[model samples]
Target: MPPRRLLLRGVLTAALVAVVSPFVHVIDFFYRREAEGVKRQKIANMRDLTPGGFIYFSYPQTGDPKIDNDPFRQFVLIMTEDGQLRVYSRVCVHLWCLPSYIQTRRQLICPCHGSIYREEDGVAIEGPAAYQSYPTNALPMGKIEVDGNGDIWMVGVDGRIGYGREWHNIKPDELVRRV
Candidate 1:
């Protein structure tokens, strides 16, 4: 084989490898990270939510619209009949539609298909949805602690309100810096 032809072939091989290697690494990295866990968001306080009221907020970490595009939103606030705060993700497991808080029905109703979720525990109580409920994907229940000032903080992924402890414990001030 000619020296020039050999050199050209080597160069082409190196270029091809260089381009493909990064893509492969990126794909692998994303999958691996996802499998381990995804950091969705952090909330400063339960006071940010009103009793029987719900609000849509962004995670800010990935800049993915919390409730609009992705499967889940940053948080959902539902003040239970007992007056305790209930926070969870807004994503519906059936078809990813953002469920609305139906005060009359006393549950989160998916406007798309009428899938009803129990606001108390995010369990699917009624409707066409087959799944038990939508996962939290972040914000552990125990981490939702209130300081002496009555400010609350939430941390973790795939957790429910008032379930357990052990959260990422992100401070409100530090949260702003991270974002």
Candidate 2:
């Protein structure tokens, strides 16, 4: 390429970066803040939930009404018959519809598309969600643990939330900040 054209290209690239950098930084900042906030969110007391029972909670409660109050942040905590705890995002992987747990069937069913997920694993076994690829077909899962006081705390979330952060499963000990 000629010197003038090369110079113009470099200048344009630099200008684009300069314009985009701030937005990128702002997004990264928000994502980091949200990730840290979700680290130890107390969902419910283990004693309050019985086998085959479930409850809903939200994560990354950032105190921003728009972001925090969105239904996509909602998750369901289910207590299995063996007393193990499992939490899955209510947002259906198909088209962002909310899935409710059918206790009698032990499945999460999305009414909008009829996508069905197995309660034990959050895997889509039927309908549109089942047709998607891998993790995209499965509901995002939140990791939880019972504290010494028997309070169930959501520690981390696995997979991508609805158009949000791609958070990997984080252990409780790995969280250095509390929100």
Candidate 3:
């Protein structure tokens, strides 16, 4: 009721707002996302990998050395028979060993568990899938696109990212920047 008391109350309210406003902005950082999103890395050449040919590379090349041990970070590009591009995660569906393409066999074969996948698309054809406790699931594939320039972009990992469980599936087009 006193003017002095009213002035003190006003000061307290202003101080409270000053302290809490930043917290509101911090909370928004976690919840708010822009309508236009991030740009994906152009990891490989589309034309270089002819049908059945393969090339290996890392995705999201952060400066962290600890990343060297992550299996999902590795990927391979395979050109399909019709020249459609497919980026297959190198980490095998079973036992998490990196699978390599055996040019002679014309398939991506896992050395650790002997799990095999077709080069064009990841399909479980043999190996660990036959065992009761072993996995029969196909290796995760990357959603791919060939831009107008004919460069291949890894848009997103098709399923849960390799053994690491990171998801990079923000569609490649979402990250495209306008000139």
Candidate 3, clashing residue pairs?
none
In angstroms, how far off is 175's CA in candidate 2? 14
Q: Rank the candidates by TM-score, best first.
A: 2, 3, 1
Best by TM-score: 2
Off by over 4 Å in 3: 1-39, 130-136, 163-179
lDDT of each: 0.52, 0.76, 0.63
lDDT, candidate 1, 74-146, per-residue tens: 4555556665655555666666677777887777777988777776666666676634323322222222334
* Backbone clashes, candidate 1: 5
Q: What is the lDDT of candidate 1?
A: 0.52
Cα lDDT tens digits for candidate 2, 1-179: 99999999999999999988878666565556555435677888868999999997778666788877677778888987776678888888888888899999989999998999988677789998898877577777776667778888887777676532244534323421223
RMSD value for candidate 3:
7.0
TM-score of model 1 (CA atoms): 0.53
Clash count for each candidate, listed in order shown: 5, 0, 0
